[model samples]
Target: MELEQFEHTIRKLFNKELLEELDDDYGFTNKSRGSFKTVGYSTNLSLETIESAAENNVELMVTHHDAWDFIYGLKEECLKKLKEYNISHFWIHGPLDFVEFGTCTSLMNVIGIDRVTKYSIYDNGDVPGVGEFNEPIDFNVLVKRMRDELEEPVRMWKNNEKQVKKVGVLTGAGHSSNYIKMALEDGCDTYITGEATLYTIQYAQFAGINLLVGSHTFTEIYGVESLAKKIQELNTAIKIVKLKEDHFELNH
Candidate 1:
């Protein structure tokens, strides 16, 4: 499928005008592709480049971030997009991380840590509710796993000296005292987020739970790719294009 065709279909379905603002708010744009190849570097006015690269027919469209920009809008956009395009759209975002076979679940599985639970407590209603692992692992062990898995050293705010057994898993900056309180309510010994803030750290310390800080992009990398890979296995004709987004740096 031509990239432009898909882009147009997606935009029309989602109402690009409304969706575009959401992307701007989150500073969403292409970040990097990590050695992945693109069809060309030239900029064309039309969707010609995307179409040429995608060829005549693209089967599936995979997005790293939520395409809707907002979940409520997402539902409406999804209904519209699905109806217009023969292409199937799959999104892997916050919920995809915590649920079984989700990103955070994948992370936990890789590390062989059990005793986890996940839920969505993001009161903002913008970010969806995600999983939280109630089981804790040694602080150092969790740290090592974060560093090794992400291929980058992580910065953390250790609110408690105790080992982390119960963990709240909210990928990205869904970090807020509200969710932290939810994790605590769920008996999570630690809270894991993509990023942290001053008040959040204080809340974690006061709540008596460990806080694990990973990059929002770094933490979310797995779920969408994993979903795409799964889609490819099911159908080879479907080309899953993982876009270069999540371009941001840790200020700390």
Candidate 2:
């Protein structure tokens, strides 16, 4: 299918307006945008992911994080590889996270939390910062379950807690003290997310709520994978490949 049509289809499927962020300064070349047969989806558009798509002959790579950040200009190496292979980058960022069944809720389900609800405030229709789990559980169990469920090691900042009944989740770097504060206000005993900030770590201890950080990339897999699955179901004419991340730095 034409790349434009493919993008349009995706926009409709995921509620385009929700995904308000895009690489406004960057877009694919005319030749590269003409067609897309195999679509690759990832939470991060790392060099590994781009190489996999290019090597596998994927026409486009859809990612939650920009392949090149605005601050860095672009990854010159990755750019050359994309141009060399004629693969395009597509981003589904903030809007993707803000959807009703997006990141927050997906994380809640993955961690096996019960009575998960979109209780966090949102910048759009979907909540970005919070999900509340109704049942309290042992802090240790929650850690073990999350590590097992995400298939990644989990880091934590604890407040000498024993149990976690009510919990809040803000997947990825969304694990902010701001949401943790709100979670505590809502009676959540623990706050779960990825990439806990330094200040937030201090705050979690002071606020007396258990804070859990699953590696940022792993916590985010749920939403993008779910998105990829939905995209795959829409049609077989288009091949969608999920470029799963294979490595995680344990002590980084």
TM-scores for all predictions: 0.58, 0.84
Point out where model 2 deviates above 4 Å: 16-33, 68-73, 119-121, 124-135, 160-162, 246-249
Best candidate according to lDDT: 2
Which pairs in model 2 have colliding backbones? 18-95, 19-95, 98-126, 135-165, 136-164, 136-165, 137-164
Among all windows of ten consecutive residues in candidate 1, which has the lowest summed lDDT? 37-46
Q: Quick one: best TM-score, which candidate?
A: 2
Question: Whole-model Cα lDDT per candidate?
Answer: 0.52, 0.70
State residue 198's C-alpha deviation in candidate 2, in Å.
Answer: 2.8
Evaluate model 1: give its TM-score: 0.58
lDDT of 1 by residue, 1-252 (tens): 344443443343333443444433222122222222221211111123234324434344354453444445644554454334343433424334333454555555554556444533223342223333355457888888888887766777677777766666776775778878876777767677777888888888887888887787767666555655554454454445544432345553
Clashes of each: 20, 7
